[model samples]
Target chain A: DAGITQSPRYKITETGRQVTLMCHQTWSHSYMFWYRQDLGHGLRLIYYSAAADITDKGEVPDGYVVSRSKTENFPLTLESATRSQTSVYFCASRVGGSSYEQYFGPGTRLTVT
Target chain B: AQSVAQPEDQVNVAEGNPLTVKCTYSVSGNPYLFWYVQYPNRGLQFLLKYITGDNLVKGSYGFEAEFNKSQTSFHLKKPSALVSDSALYFCAVRDAGNAGNMLTFGGGTRLMVKP
Candidate 1:
């Protein structure tokens, strides 16, 4: 009921297809982020939003798109999924007061074949 | 650019023994450091943080970290290792003045505590 929640915990998509991973937070945190986790890479941010209409790219933003129309939701879209995009994706949020301590969602494991 | 480094890819310790996982950082201003633990199939869990004040900050699961400004390191330590302590640990740093709380994380160190 509270905290962050990620939808479609497991997803399988064909290469070139579009897929979107959803993230929702109940805390109403001002800062929300999306990251992809892979072996050896740990976690790298893909995109982050400071507010509903303000968003920016992170370390790995290529081929991915993100939008935050409301504070509670931040969605990550893969316009044309590739095999390299097959990895676990996580959503996180932190209040503007202390953006340092982020709360992470369980994650969405996406597979592109 | 600010970044963090965890020297060891993995650390093995016998149960009941003290354990440590090393981390180092580079930043332009005062650093806000943090440690997070992640189990398989789970998101990273917040461990401890060193913002200001004291160098030694204690966290959940009997874990603590010592910040050494001179050494530019923040190493995680536990008094006695437990088998269940096995997990992936990450060290992160943020430039307190301008980083806006977005943490730059270390690659991560996996801990294996054996009985």
Candidate 2:
């Protein structure tokens, strides 16, 4: 509620189903990002928003969508879940200007069977 | 585009010994480097960063990083290790000249501190 939070810390879904992961931050930061973590790939950016209503694709944007209509919210959606999409999702935010650090959420573990 | 590399998959150190985690990066423009640590089930926690000035940067939990321009590396270091310091370490880089300022992270290195 204060820093950054991800809903449904753990979720189990089946392939072909639709799922959405919610992220909320109270810091009013202008930059928000979505990332997925895997074993050898580390963390790959899925999507990022510079401000409300301004979102862009990252290194790994396949099979994922993100929208940020409010400065405090950024949601990632999976139109059709797949086993390859199963991984931990992280939400992060950074202040505008010269700041270089991004604050991260606790993360959501999604499992697709 | 910016990219980062962490060469070691894992580093084992005994308690009270000095420790270091290596990181290298490539960026089209000036580099902004960072280090983050993650516990078993927790998200990444910022450790330190190097933007400009003083190549030596200090950060949370008794951690420090040195930015080497010539080598294009920013390595994390600590004077002594602790059992509680074991975690996954990641290195990230950003291009200061890039407007987006998006950070690219390394594959990560596991630091195992043994007693």
Candidate 3:
């Protein structure tokens, strides 16, 4: 309950539809990150937020959008979902620093048909 | 540009035996290396990291990694393996020169520990 958590641990949506995955962390970490896990590609960062209202694109930011209105929450949105976007999404958080370790949420498995 | 490479796709070991998972990285400057484990249907769990100081860094669950700067490698190791350790392990790196602190993860290596 106190640790990070993600909503709709599993999701199914159609292509071209909009879907949003929610992530919340009780730690109130300054840095929040969104990553997608895919076979062969491993885990690629989609977006990251340094603090409230501060966000930046990661390695694989195409086809995805993210917002950090609150330090405790960072939500990722798909404007127009595609089959290629279907993958396991993970959210992580860490204190703002050079050597801080990141903590991850359970993850959301999204399938776009 | 920063990138990581996990040479082996999978590793198999017997319980109680020593285990090793190899990882290599390329970064623009000093590297911040890390190891994470992911179980079935689960998110990645932080294992260990090598920021500076000692070449050998010890972390959670009796896991440790040795950072070799010359070789640009950080291999995870455990003295004795357990069946519970069977999972997907990922190696990541961040370029110290970059201020964003973005991590680049390797293609992950699945460890199969047989009891």
Best by lDDT: 2
Task: Give the residue spans of candidate 1 off by over 4 A.
Answer: B99-101
DockQ of each candidate relative to the true complex: 0.73, 0.87, 0.87
- Residue pair clashes in candidate 1: none
> Could you give candidate 2's per-residue lDDT for residues A6-55 as a string of tens digits?
99899999999999999999999999999999998999999999999999
> CA lDDT of A78 in candidate 1?
98
Model 2 docking tier (incorrect/acceptable/medium/high): high
- The interface RMSD value for candidate 3 stands at 0.7
Order of the predicted models by TM-score, top scorer first: 2, 3, 1
* Clash pairs (backbone) in predicted model 3: none
Clashes of 3: 0
Q: Candidate 1: which docking quality band?
A: medium
Error of 1 at B29 (Å): 1.1
Residues B2-45, model 3: lDDT tens digits: 99999999999999999999999999899999999999988889
Ranking of models by lDDT: 2, 3, 1
Give the backbone clash total of model 2. Answer: 0
Q: At residue B17, what lDDT does model 1 achieve?
A: 100
